[model samples]
Target: MGVFYRAPEPGAKPFVAEGDLITRGQQVAIIEAMKLMIPVEADASGRVLEILVADGTPVEHGQPLLTVATGDADRAGPGR
Candidate 1:
């Protein structure tokens, strides 16, 4: 499973599971900074399996925000 990066504040918009399929730098969610939209992106390619944070929920830096299964079981690495 992949780890989700959390926003650094409370009452922020967390990543969206149904959002666009993103790559390493694609926007996943938005955080309001000075009334500006900050885009969040995926660090790796995978299907989002679950959301750890709720909508409009408070979050902190370095917190887990979601769970993603890479979807490629073949790539699980060295332990097959």
Candidate 2:
């Protein structure tokens, strides 16, 4: 229900990247819909393995934006 909007500028560093370790509740990216910006956060702590979605792409609810190598499978949460 939203479009994935990453990085504030064309060459700005992304909030997170592959091989980057992130903790629970860390800001990952932003979703823009109706001109409002929504922040995406991590649900678990782990190393980011990959980014599943590209910037400026539309994403659905519960869509995974990235993958994390967490200790617990049930806790793996890179995005909603």
Candidate 3:
């Protein structure tokens, strides 16, 4: 199974999705809500497999922002 990223708000403007693997510090996407620009982050170290949102599209909270295939997904604890 892969990890999925979800939007944090409902009917919010979508940001640009950078389908690039982010080891620790990387900008994945942005969420524009109430004229505020919020950056979405990648939570794990892996390759970015899919981006589920289009630029300027309205996104909902808990929506799948992207999917990542982390090699440590089967681990019992956080990735080291």
**Comparing 1 and 3 by TM-score, which wins?**
3
After the best TM-score superposition of candidate 2, give how far the Cα of residue 78 lies from its true spot, in angstroms. 4.9
lDDT score, candidate 1? 0.49
- The CA lDDT at 65 in model 2 is 89
lDDT of 1 by residue, 4-36 (tens): 334445556544454334355456655454455
| Segments in model 3 whose C-alpha atoms lie over 4 Å from true places | 1-19, 73-80
Better of 1 and 3 by lDDT: 3
Q: Against the true structure, candidate 3 has what lDDT?
A: 0.54
TM-score of every candidate relative to the true structure? 0.55, 0.85, 0.61
Candidate 3 lDDT over residue span 1-80, tens digit each: 12222434445543223454455345566667776777766566666676765555677766776666666643222111
Candidate with maximal TM-score: 2
Q: Between the candidate structures 2 and 3, which one is better when assessed by lDDT?
A: 2
RMSD of 2: 2.2
Tens digits of per-residue lDDT, candidate 2, 1-80, equal 99886576568988888899888888888888888888988888889898998988999988888888886744654444
Clashing pairs in 2: none
Lowest lDDT 10-mer window, candidate 3?
Answer: 1-10
